[model samples]
Target: MTDATARPVRSSPRPTGTPLRAFGALMLRDTRVLSRELLPFIVRVIMQPLLFLFVFTYLFPRMGGGNGMMMGGGSFATVLLPGLMAVAIMFTGIAAVALPLSTEFGVTREIDDRVMCPLPVYAVALEKICFSALQCIFAALLVLPLAYYIPSTPVLLHVSSWPVFVAVMILASLVSGALGLTIGASVQPRQIGLVFSIVVIPITFLGCVYYPWALLSHVRWLQIVVLANPIVYMSEGLRTALTPGMPHMPVLAVLAGLVGSLAVLGTIGVRNFLRRVIS
Candidate 1:
């Protein structure tokens, strides 16, 4: 016979929380998990952008790779700064949302725990998007310092309008999160790797990240084609806000693209998420 004192203590069950509380709790859970993996998170966020800046800004310029490698003979670092930040934000959203969501939805079934929360299913998807946006914002902040100092040339940043800068950052981050959500909900776990190859690669290369979009006037047809890429707006938008000296798309067009993409991607992501959860 076991002694009463030796037996494990049972905790009382708590009621399912209200929707706002549930949402906050879910966000908190993600925060705790990320905190535990802080090292890996930092590495994942910094490695690519850091290496890219080092090679292109520091090494290539020093190695007799002339201003031809630069953007219109201005400092490459200035052009690269906004672009790298955009890439950082985009990468963070996909990594934070898509990879984990696919695994949880497919193999681990860990999503069930979150789904069983008292909140609505669409709320769940929104939480994922919101959380990923937070991460994207944070990832961009992390890249900012690295982009500033690591380059051989000076990185010039002049925020023409504070409100525009703030608006673009928030809107662009939401678009990225929504895109990640759509991919996570729609793609099968086994085929997720294909997303990086087909979708991610093409978008990054064509995103106007390495150069100004206005320069693409020489390739007018290609310019029209790349406008379809959401990331083109992101890179150009950041260039508008941070590097006003750089050639970028109009503020109106950038805002329009981001808002439209957010609406489209967010709707599809929520619908797909609900279907996946119910099925």
Candidate 2:
């Protein structure tokens, strides 16, 4: 063969901007997938929060005069609104990321495609977080009206610290997403039900969904246990932002702990997920 014919043709170098473009495309693709699968996720996210709203905001106010503000001290509805909204974000993050992750890692082996993407392993994990965080925002909006209408007492919906509220909302979603990643990577697909029964229940009860960490002082030991719960920080942080008058954990301390814990847990989850995929 001639020297020219023997030489192999080289393709143009891959685009230098491929990573950003790919990341955006990946985000949009996941968003479309989530949109199609949204109904069940929405239902699951809203159900438990709604139940708590009705029982505490609607029922308890009439029966016990607590309305929604931490067993009758503050505006029960107002207090529960932010706290429960935080809880809903937590649930949405878990349901959107964790449950499907187990399935993808198990029955479907669908995560293999994600691993094959040109992005770093962390990008795949980040995609999960981004997808679930979007759901968290949606769930928060869906439950806001309930927060407004359900309480018997005159409830406030102050947003004096709009920036803080938004920041805390994002923080709450990140914490939940990190927790979901850890749980998703740690559990077997068949054992996810066990997570719901044990992990989810304990987190919801101990997470300050119904009361602030301050009120838990009466049960000091339980308080310590729940103080370790990320949800407590998220709930308290959110409540503080929404209700300026409500007492809460020191914002700096709670935010620091939550962000730090999420970093640690999320690192472990990424390592675990990468190992699982490669194996």
Candidate 3:
């Protein structure tokens, strides 16, 4: 009777939903949040590119700057368009991942909720990368049309190869996303502004945003130095894809560099993110 009363207990099995489902759920949630903030996102995405177009492509040309002479006979607008697009994508990726991550890792402690989910810790970092990459793509699309039509100086853009253009855009966005993840995970909340000044400012100006990478050849050492800046490849890749007739970096080199950057930065970012979350 005593033995019968002490019945065996069975532990319940874990939940049945797959990692895919969890990832999808998290993505969907992020999409919904993005949708709600669509207006601000659009404004943020558009503002910098708009200023660049207005000042460099429009006002400067009208103010006696030669329309195309600055960039080796290619229309300044044409040269600038791709660089501006790269800037938009880069900024989108950084803002999409970094700011929220800072807050989550800061006093809000919201990251706990995310890590507590059924998904693996690395999946959370991956979700950030994917989400930011998508945002970067969308930003690129928006900037492309605006860049083509909005400039008062007629911009001549010819896609030499659609495949190359697509490849550059996708690869650049991924690199940007990975960079954002690494920066987000590594920077403390209080040092965010300093990091931007020290890291982001130099990247933007030295990124070949206002000029072509090939133009650096006149200053031999600069050409070699700028090669280390990932954005140079992105800008050059876009220049190659969009204006193949103009001087640009070799396509194979750009592609190879981007792939390498993605691997290294993505690995470091995920490891740092895991450390931050687990600690």
Candidate 4:
């Protein structure tokens, strides 16, 4: 017979750890995987900008006997410097999250296993965005030094304010990550290529990457129209910080656009992620 005074022992708490710990662990795992794929990652980030710079800034000038002038009068490479960085950031973010995520959400349903971590489902989504943002940062930085070395003509980059430069880099990276999440969640695996063809190409061509927004006076309607593209702000914002001697959008508008884009995209991505997971 059990002793009358003996009480039932309480069970121990779960060893699952806190949500933040799980979130960090998820990111760490992704980081480890990325470390193994370093060669491919470097190749993917550098190829587009390197080839474009080689052709346009180096070969084209030698072929054409001159370079195109930017809006406020600078070498094409000057314009391309910030613009290419922006593209790298945007493309890296999309590739980091959207491409793999589409496959995970496909027949594999690998995303289900990821969401089953002890952390909240939204935290899992946030992990994707945050890690993608980090890759965006790295891809963008890789583009930065290339501008100095790649162009036969000088790529003039004058950073008047380091704080502003850093801030734009961060906000723009996050915006791209959020945009990636939205794309990843909305587009099925089969349809993602279509997204790049229709959505991404159009936006990039129209995003004022090769020119300044202020120079669009000749095409006022098109200028007004392209403002709707988040990439416009990124290119413009970077142009402002990196090439201050050149004309750029108002600082207020750049900051506002980045903030607004982040908010809108983040909300939509989280909602779509939740719906996809729950359904």
Q: What's the CA RMSD of model 3 in angstroms? A: 2.2
TM-score of each: 0.91, 0.91, 0.93, 0.95
Model 3, residue 265: distance off in Å is 1.1
lDDT of 2 at 212: 71
Error of 1 at 185 (Å): 0.5
**How do all the candidates rank in terms of TM-score, highest first?**
4, 3, 1, 2
CA displacement after TM-score superposition, residue 159 of candidate 2 (Å): 1.8
Q: lDDT of model 4 at residue 169?
A: 92
Number of backbone clashes in candidate 1: 0
lDDT of 2 by residue, 73-124 (tens): 5766776777788788888888877888998998679898876778887788
lDDT of 4 by residue, 82-147 (tens): 888888989999999999889989997999999888988998988899999999999999987777
For model 2 the local lDDT of residue 114 reads: 75
Ranking by lDDT: 4, 1, 3, 2
Best by lDDT: 4
**TM accuracy, model 3:** 0.93
Kindly report which residue stretches of model 3 are placed more than 4 angstroms away from their true locations once superposed. Answer: 1-17, 65-69
lDDT of 3 by residue, 1-279 (tens): 468778689898876777878899899999999999999999999999988888877787778856533576777888888888889888898898888889999987899999877889999999999989899989988888787777767777889999999999889999899999988899997887888899988988998888888788789898898778888888889989987877888999999988988898899999999999988
How far residue 222's Cα lies from its native spot in candidate 4, in Å, is: 1.7
Q: Residue-wise lDDT of candidate 1 within 1-279, one digit each (tens)?
A: 778789688887766668889999999999999999989999999998999999998898889756425575468888988888889989899888899988889866888888898888899999999999988888888988897788887788889999998888898899899999999999998888999999998999899999999999999999999988889989999999998887889999999999998999999989998888888
**Superposed Cα RMSD, model 1:** 6.9
